[model samples]
Target: MTATAAAPEEDGTAPAGGGTASGQDASRPVRQIVPPEDLHATELAFLAAHDSGPRPPGWRLTPRSVVTFVMGSHGAALTLPDDARAAAGTPRRLVIDGKFVGDRALVERCVVTLAGERALLLVGEPGTAKSMLSELLAAAVCGTSGLVVQGTAGTTEDQLKYGWNYAQLLAGGPSPAALVPSPVLTAMSRGAIGRVEEVTRCLPEVQDALVSLLSERRIAVPELAGGPDGLAHATPGFNLIATANLRDRGVSEMSAALKRRFNFETVGAIGDLDAETALVRRQARAALERSGAAFQVDDAVLEALVTAFRDLREGRSAEGWEVERPSTVMSTAEAVAVAGALGLAAAYFPGDRDVLELLPGHLLGVVRKDDPADAARLRGYWDGPVRRRAEEGAATWRALWDLRTVLEG
Candidate 1:
């Protein structure tokens, strides 16, 4: 079957309906956050046709293409050959934009792990895009990114393994028809990728359920034992991609046995200043676009915003001056959010206040999240870096230095 072909139901039949479960109007308002699969469907289909190389079983694209899909084509346009161009809904020429702005090698490692059918664990700081990478990888590998379990303190083993429809069970008495498969179980049966976000947040016992599933690659349905639907075996491409935040390390630590079942990759913040600034701009602009407003934040203001975040994040200035790091993470994701707020402020309240004037307040808000003392740390940052930069006569830093009172309040 082609990459775009609709997947069959667990019972090996095409889905009955052509409409949504609610039968909501198709022309009604769309979702705020579209899934990666639907958002980049065309790119996936194009890449599938673009590369006819050997793919791992049950995979939509070759492993190499999966990496390219995540890291992008690096500004080079990929032209679909004449034969492949005729495939419906795919553009003849397209430049795949980079989604995750981290190391290419890290993405490659993730793809390789999935290709090998081993569970992949992405551990990172709270806002380092681990979930985004998981979603993108799942979307690229299996043509769908919807198979996911959001880990939480309330999470249960049933969420990772299986549950049952109580009414259906009462009617059918433990039949396969009564089963409600978890996202992981469904992925096992269909050879798709399943994601578990913030796995560390789940209770330790609830999290341990994955140990047997990852090792054995099958889920046993004891209720249906000796029947045709007794056990659900994993299809060839079945794999799991889980994300955990570094900040949540001790919340529900994984057992050594459970940890051994997966390949762990640590995703870190973007290292390059220019790349981070560009990403902040791109993400902020996307946010503004979603809100139906133009992105009017200036480049100099964005650079200054990013610079302050980096200085605080790294605990040192670009000029090698010491900075007292705050207890809270000054992540790039937070930077993007602040930039988006600035854009909105500029678009909605033009000339009400300079956008640059709003930066310190936003930074103060971010810094004060974990501890109030961090506000003092932020003030110290201003008294140090802001003071030095202003003394150096850079106009943007001088403007920020003049607004130290914003942080004071």
Candidate 2:
């Protein structure tokens, strides 16, 4: 049965009644990071309570509510009726939180596509939150986002379809009980979203496994055809959400046949600097707090770091100043990581070691990858953007420009 989460108390946090995936163990002093599906269980229930719109088969919320869950509620409120509240002996109101920040039109299109049969494919440059968006969509569509396949060169067809439990196979032969369902198969049978991450990282042959499953909406278990197990046909709501890095596109490009089965959506980096900076600080503080550390990374340092990354990522300033783009992706994810590291450094190793001194080195680490020429490209960044910005009399730029030697190391 789908669990109904308790409405939030006067504060935003949910009441204790609804059991969520985020419930901590009383026996162990450990932090458990919950997925979107679990973390927003109550919120989803609340949305469902107020939704009167039509939904696709097997969907938990109306398409409108799904979009609201992602883009956030723009002052939409759902208050329990007086009679219902009195009857239930509880008072509650549902106010949804906007989770993902991006183009509303894009999110609306994605929701519309997922409501139908065509699989959704999100392609983007690194750090674009393509995967995060996919997860949120999956969680909101169904109630679980655990059915996922991480695509890699070594990922086999068995991982996408079905595998044999060796012990059961040996003891009982290739029977129904011996067959282990892959995430894709599990999603197919249960009518849930199955995710394929880094789809291009897998070899052409292995990646092709999805083509048949998606087109036919089924997977045949040939070995058990004569017995109990045969074809696993998809249920009404079965769908796929695949993500590929733009950098990895041509590596093992999906065949045109495979691409045709998907609705392609591109997830790009945050367009606004303030939004990106807030995301960085929010993610960094959350990460730091999880590690039992106070986040003391200065706002000035974060702004400087995000500004540098934005410049390097776009190869141009917000003012349209030209800069040399790095060969590697300087994604917002990398920026969040750098921010987290800087915060931890401040909390643990408090001293005269200036946080600004570490920015150039961390950026160097982000850019210095694969191609040897990337380091040169980063050095060129310091000379061009850093030099120009410092000349404009910005103290942060002046400090980073002064530390040009750090990039060299």
Candidate 3:
């Protein structure tokens, strides 16, 4: 029988009529939030003695189960025993969220690189979802996403290494208490994936701090008097994943040495118009639903919006028509945002003609973020590719093109 009662006060005292009268079943299991995968590194090694598979040392489940945990599986349902299950609560459904939207082969390549000994660097334009994917990968591998170093202009060697606590440093003179481990150091000790986001944003000197760490698989702290002699040795399954934005080109370029340490993968922007449209539609619907608003967007309006973005992104249209691309990145995330704006407009205006009426203006707002020269690029796209497509008797696109003045005005 299930028991429902108000929780007791924090002073360790019960309310009136305490003692089991509250119908409290003290033996009930508390809910937990574990990853969908059944095993962890230590547990996997213990199971390896009885089970049969290619078990990598320090990994919880076999590599195959790890894959299923991340991508979801259709075979036998993997489960944890009641004891383990109750201790950790129910496992999170292995729902692989967006990281990279483009190539499966690239993801496979990254997975393989991590499975081996190499570090992986995900390079892409801003808002292309590189860091998100890295987070997902790290969470999948180690069952934790807490190890991270966010790269920036002000990031220092100490931020990536150990920093001395001033009070402890003065008291004990570089003792272990004075040493505070950076995220990278902690990940090395735990054998988990350490993430560094916006890697190129860090100044060259600061970025170089990773070179020694990756090559040696250890962090050396000369000042700390009594911590592992000199080096902080990495545990067995430790790895690193870093993300750099390509749009931030020419700003603090990565050293050749650091580049060689990682297997680089460049994530591309959404190229297919249909794919972009579908993604926008799905994302917008979900957002509206979350907001407790009814999603009533027209499919044709979404297609037009995506087509405009694709043309501005690629500097061309589907039918061999030339268009001037925008200086801004026409990312999938931005497409979803624009679609969401239109949805909001629909919810408010109710009769704002159609969502297509808001497309060109939203496109203009995004493309005109930086240089005024971007305005010319956007106008060129409409005149060339959009004009050609409209002239070719594409009805829906023609209607959107008719709103070209929205860009100029």
TM-score of candidate 1 on Cα atoms, chains taken together: 0.92
Provide the lDDT at 148 for model 3. Answer: 89
Per-prediction TM-score to the true structure, in the order listed: 0.92, 0.90, 0.77
RMSD of 2: 4.1
* Candidate 1 CA-lDDT value: 0.87
Over 5-90, each residue of candidate 3 has an lDDT whose tens digit, in order, gives: 53344643323222222123336442222222221322222222222456455554455544443443333233344333322322
Ranking by TM-score: 1, 2, 3
**lDDT of model 3, residue 202:** 96
lDDT of 2 by residue, 278-313 (tens): 888988886886677888988989998998899888
Which regions of candidate 2 fall more than 4 Å away from where they truly are? 1-32, 74-91
Judged by lDDT, which candidate is best?
Answer: 1
State the displacement of the C-alpha of residue 6, model 2, in Å, after optimal TM-score superposition: 13
Q: Residues 174-264, candidate 1, lDDT per residue (tens digit)?
A: 9888899999999999999999999999999998889988988888999999987898999899999999999999999999988998899
The residue pairs found clashing in candidate 3 are 32-89, 40-60, 41-60
